[model samples]
Target: MERRSHIYGVMGEFATPEQLTHAVEKVREAGYRRLDAYAPFPVEGLSQALGLKRNLVPLITLLGGLAGGVGGFGFQYWVAAITYPMNIGGRPLNSWPAFIPVTFELTILGASLAAVFGMLALNKLPQPHHPVFNVHRFSHASADRFFLCIEARDPKFHLADTARLLQSLHAHHVSEVSDD
Candidate 1:
């Protein structure tokens, strides 16, 4: 068996979302950037309280769509105009209007794919485990409880002071989380 010695962070269990939100706000105000919140359901305004910035998934999706559109049109144009050209019935080989459907379909496909993959990548999904799971109380996070955690890696994170702050914020329980 491997001996675990590293501390991941300190976690506070709250009875309500409001308390959890307040704790996050206060922790942020105290200059702790490495913090996260969890609740059984979505908590309104929690993202703002955490001071999270806008994500880049939209831009990524747009770029993917544009690339797909250009690629689709270029490929069609190359095939019709250069690769296997046939001027049938006095009609032009490079028909821009004819490629609209395939281009549009490819654009939608690219955007949808980019949105899915980009969101997963940005959120770092597929993780088998996280250090917070070490706290047995965290299981309630998927139920009725709310939680706030301040990582030890934060510059302003002092274990004693952070625990005291959480206690002052009306946490039901405060515990240390070990990164085993």
Candidate 2:
């Protein structure tokens, strides 16, 4: 049996957003996946460089709202007609008009709950740790500095070769992004 060596991601630091964006494109063209760019402010071409498709947040929100509406309608119908029925002034036992307000409120409530939970889950919130945090210079990510990190998890990742590739991309500085 043979053992494989672990390879981690490489981090390229940049002084300007332009350099970061350009380097990102070079990285993508170099045929690397599992890379992410970070900057204090959003850049125009950053998302395209990272090859991110549309976010699933909206889809989750929509599904949640649909479920909420259906649940609201079903619950009201069951309670009014099946659970307990009453006749007032010979009116129909299933009083649709009076139940409308409750149904509407419940729909809104359920949708709101779904939106909150869905957003959190989609964003993978409560993640207090990340390998990028190990880089002391990463704090600058929230400042004026911009960076692109190529994760070792990529299929083509090779430790020295990846670092060399970033260097060839004219990155200001390249360093290993480590989890340890």
Candidate 3:
């Protein structure tokens, strides 16, 4: 079949989370990988059904925190020992204990900022529009409806076969999403 360039994918709206989850599992079993589900609230075990991997936010946060801590401590050491060395009461110029509080605060700050930014970046936030919004019924996704979309970009996606699969899974409505 000839692929349509303007077609985003085929979307199936389901009545409940259960049906959506089941459809997702069935679609995955049928070898379709590029698919997404939407619901008003979080659905348990939906990630596993979608075959999602572990999140990378924690690792990003750790790296940010380490950078902040190291940078803070290094700055303090540079000022105290190299840039402006002070010898007061025969005390050493490099004071490690005095830098602990600032280092700790900077670490916390960096970790929180990293988490916020990482989450936004990973989720692709600030998106004012998406191809799914072109469907009139998709507005219900924020209310009570659940939806599953099989993207046209998926290697196994064929408009007719995907629509049939969604219909066979007892979808309330199946429609084609347009990229335009």
Candidate 4:
């Protein structure tokens, strides 16, 4: 196994959603721009508190749809009229009407594919390992607990200072999370 230095980060475990929300707000106001929050369920205003902007899901879908439309139409046009022209019923090889169905199908197919794949890529899915998981208490986060983990890699992070900040935010416990 390849061994690497452990990267430690401050983590604030909150017992309640309200504490998590309030902690998030204070963390932001404290100028720690790289903090994150976790809860059993979505917490209102948490995104705003973390200064997260709107996602690019819509933009990705739009571009994917455009590419699919153009690709489907272009491919069909080429195969039917240019590459291997097939003429039936004396209807021109470039029969756009015949291509409509495939083109439409491809447009929808591409948009759906992009929405799923793009979201996964953007969110960095398939991460089998994460430093937060190192915290034994973190499993509870998926249940009734709420958590906020600020990575040590954050520009403003200083081991002691970050932990102190988390404590000041009234977290139940501010533990150091290590990427092992």
The prediction achieving the highest TM-score against the true structure is 3
The sequence of per-residue lDDT tens digits that candidate 4 reaches over residues 66-101 is 889999999999999999986687989888998999
Per candidate, the number of residue pairs that clash is: 0, 0, 0, 0
Q: Give me the displacement of residue 135 in model 2, in angstroms.
A: 0.5
lDDT of 4: 0.85
- Model 2 misplaced stretches (Cα beyond 4 Å): 1-7, 168-170
Of the pair 2 and 3, which is ahead by TM-score?
3
Residue pairs whose backbone atoms clash in candidate 3: none
Positional deviation of residue 29's Cα in model 2 after best superposition, in angstroms: 0.4
Best by lDDT: 3
55-126, model 1: which lDDT tens digit per residue?
A: 899999999899888988999999999999998998989889999999999999888899999999998997
After aligning candidate 3 to the native by TM-score, how far in Å is the CA of 147 from where it should be?
A: 0.9
Score every model by TM-score: 0.90, 0.81, 0.92, 0.86
Task: Please write out the lDDT profile of model 3 over residues 1-180, one tens digit for every residue.
Answer: 447889999999999999999999999999999999999999998999999999999999999899889998999999999999998998988879998999999999888889999999999998999999999999999999999999999989899999999999999899999999
